[model samples]
Target: MNHHDPLLEQLNQLISEGRNPDTLHIDTASTLDIVTAINTEDHKVAPAVAACLPDIARAVDYIADALQNGGRLIYTGAGTSGRLGILDAVECRPTFSVPDTLVVGVIAGGKTAIEHAVEGAEDDHGQGALDLADIRLSAHDVVVGLSASGRTPYVTGALAYARQTGCKTIGVACSPNTPVLQAADVAICPLVGPEALTGSTRMKSGTAQKLVLNMLSTATMIKQGKTYQNLMVDVNATNHKLKARARRIVMQATDCDEATATDALQQADQQAKLAILLVLTGLDVESARTLLSQQNGYLRHALKAHC
Candidate 1:
């Protein structure tokens, strides 16, 4: 065993890999005490995320501008980071009625890695570059690299490839000044400190990344006219719950009765934004839809035009 190995040194230097002094006595404490310690540490995650708001906002602007101009938002990572990226990407379709192609998630070991661990997948730096290349990455795309460790080869490689393609790159990690952050055009590092369980980035670091990813996708969608009056106007009502929600959104947006909302939604092909416009403006479905399209799908703008 080599004592001065660089990998060993790197791990030793990582704050995420360091033991938590707050939880040092957990082994001998009661279960309640142990959970309390974990809870205390979890409370620190939000403020850490809040500290990176400026950087996160900058990343959002880059992603939103690129997407508005016919670009995609690409998330690439390994392990837990990769899984979080995929979760955020898959959600955009149903949440905002956006095409899946508009937001893609590239995991280190491919789709198989999502449900099961793929050993050595994150260690291959070149594979990350290849995965983005396979997707036909374009200059208009914005690539976000997720790596809690801040030094994952897979994330760094993807960011490097994105930069090479002249795409805007955003790096998200929980550690400061690491390769993943440095490689990004817009770096968002939320220092959540060491985990309650030593070296388990799946905990605090993962939570921070999840928060940031949520902001990135949600804010970008809002900027893209996917919402109306704080409602998910473009929400894909594929099931009963969302269908009910869509009707409710129409009612809320137009202050119409439930029956009126249902009728407008039926006439407007279940599009909440269109339904709301029909109820508020008394325009026919086609006319309301034309108005929405003219306003770039912004319900507020469409409503103002009718006024």
Candidate 2:
């Protein structure tokens, strides 16, 4: 027994690192068989994530509360986890019309790490705290730490610092009984079991994390009134595709013809929510805008006020 092999011992205890008995013969399998095996393993991800829905819902409430109080939602992780955080954060701006700063992503080794692996970056726990500090993380904000193993020093450090600063912390991982789970105020673990290729968490683990993240951000945005009756009313119509989407949303929300939708959108300055309001409430752009402002952009509330 090698007493110095602590990492080996740690890996041994992780179900994610264990070999999949079902795929033991994958190396000798045909192409179709290999894909079938991977597909079978992939099917477990959704149910595993479903098991953590209660915790995910709790995190979403915390996140929405933080944002409502003029706070931000920040995510921190390493490698694939880090990339996922960045991806989600960037998408929020265009999807919900929120400022980019409202959703921040902090990786272990900075921007370059998003494209290439930064050797030893995850091991520097202190750097994680520093990264959050550098961004001026505040007590009202929420920090979500992502780590498949749930023991990445970088994520643990960030969560610890977030707690000290009075920020709400949530940990997302693929394994249980981890340091991150213990550190965070809420822990979301999706135990997808061993990978088809042993220890490659970027497979099932990554998928699980992405699904949870989707729920966290989308649900929080919904709670904050970013959506109007399942439509992304707050969408930023910056590009051609988005502008087309905005028109379609107005038509859908109001059940109006394309010409009416187009006229409403133009009168409302191309704002989908305002266009929908104008069509549904039969109000001029200014009155619709005023009601929307009073309701803090909640279209349903504004509609109710007019009705």
Candidate 3:
């Protein structure tokens, strides 16, 4: 089969596909020279992400609203972008003590696609809509589409279906002026320029996408009162390390000794935020729980009310 499609050629015209003049001679350069060239390109990723802060902030607000209303935040993409979405979704549960259903990741080819490439999966627009449908996406949800090229048919289809279903949509893309952006209610385009090795977007573009996902999840959780003064107050102490961290969080929040913090955590039924409230406000476990509940788990707000 002849693989020379005009659309592919047009896609190659995208900035992500443009070859970097700086790395043209990398093949003949020393190892240090190649590293330096790639490092120079990598330096552009942060500022590119910084340029899209407004869009990212908008996304965070949208996600926080959806989550607060009992709706899930869904991320859809293909390839490296898909993996990044899943990475962010999986981390949210342990990091913020949220349920897995609250944040979801839908890759183009399903769970099997996480480890192996599913041929032509990204090209299947209908499957994209089907994937979201399978999740029972609703009007209260927010769907974020991740596409390095900004034209993945899978993501574009998801965004369209999400809009049709009255779900809010956000698009994160590395290239400027693409379909994913047009399909989304809010577009976050981090123009990281071309890859050091031509069309390899998994490097710089992947880094930018990861950064945006970090901001989206972290900021949304912060808005939801998951953190208490920069500490992971809602952290799930499901493991030894996390339990230690939870204890430390209580200690840090109330300036209490380790023994007192540990005792408070135990008295509060191993709940970090409640323990902190108990220690800081000198309230019983039930009163601390009530105050935290009244403030929607915002430690600072609960502290202000009792202190």
Candidate 4:
């Protein structure tokens, strides 16, 4: 098999099938005409994702089940895929108050790769195994592999390793007939079709992956009682900005005045989840703390018991 041959052919097909934004006849025609064409193309993305909502939902439910049992969520990818994984994990803390250890992202070339591409890092299957080992993957974890081509060696290896260890694994790819999908327990193939830039999955494919990951992580957090009636009840007030948000969240959830919210937050020692619980149940800090400890740190559960 000629290593260069596949790449050359793929490149040629890419150029042939790619949409030439330059060829678009978007001149000084009425602004309406220009807007129409752009809108038409953008509209295609949602329908593409809509067609696969069932599959995406299935993957999310699977992940939620694992996480309920103390499982972690891990993402594996290379380059743009890796960056997206990291992005999702990082956002969990601020968005849902998840601990950093709950969501792990394994990039192909490690931390250095996030900034600069590491040559041939994607091809290293052994490295993928090593990274998973370092993270101490267990059967209670879920591994998600992201690859546009559905064939990145590193991601495939990580998914394979995770499955072997009795952990649930998911593969998300833009293209059809990807090997990574076949290896994973749940395969999410968002048929965004070919990219406008041909093989550049970072275009439509990347957007689809981002949407799916958002749904997965957000839905999981909600399922775990991190939210209280659509409000973020588990916010971490680690900084001044977050402390302000914590007070606001408490106020919103309990319909308390700003002073009362501030008092609750202070009583809970700046722990937003506990503060919300205390305000909602009208419990003192010690009672709220005991209720939360009994309810697995879920503010909603603690509130239900106390109130």
Best by lDDT: 2
Window of ten residues with lowest summed lDDT in model 4:
14-23
Candidate 4 local lDDT, residue 177: 63
In candidate 1, which residue ranges exceed 4 Å CA deviation? none
**Tens digits of per-residue lDDT for model 2, 1-307:** 6356888889889887889999999999999999999999999999999999999999999999999999999999999999999999999999999999999999999999999999999999999999999999999999999999998999999999999999999999988999988999999999999999899999999999999999999999999889999999999999899989999999999899999999998998888999999999999888889999999999999999988
TM-score of each: 0.98, 0.98, 0.97, 0.87
Number of backbone clashes in candidate 4: 0
lDDT of each residue in 174-212, candidate 4, tens digit only: 766667889888888777655544456777778888988
Off by over 4 Å in 3: 1-4
lDDT of each: 0.93, 0.95, 0.93, 0.81
Global lDDT for candidate 1?
A: 0.93
Error of 4 at 264 (Å): 0.8
Per-residue CA lDDT of model 3 for 1-307, tens digit only, reads: 7779888786787888888888999899999999999999999999999989888998999999998898999999999999999999999999999999999999999999999999999999988899999999999999999999998999999999999999999999987889999999999999999999988989999999999999999999999999988999999998899999999999998889999999999998778999988888888888889988899888889999986
Clashes of each: 0, 0, 0, 0
Q: List the residue pairs that clash in candidate 3.
A: none
Residue pairs clashing, model 1? none
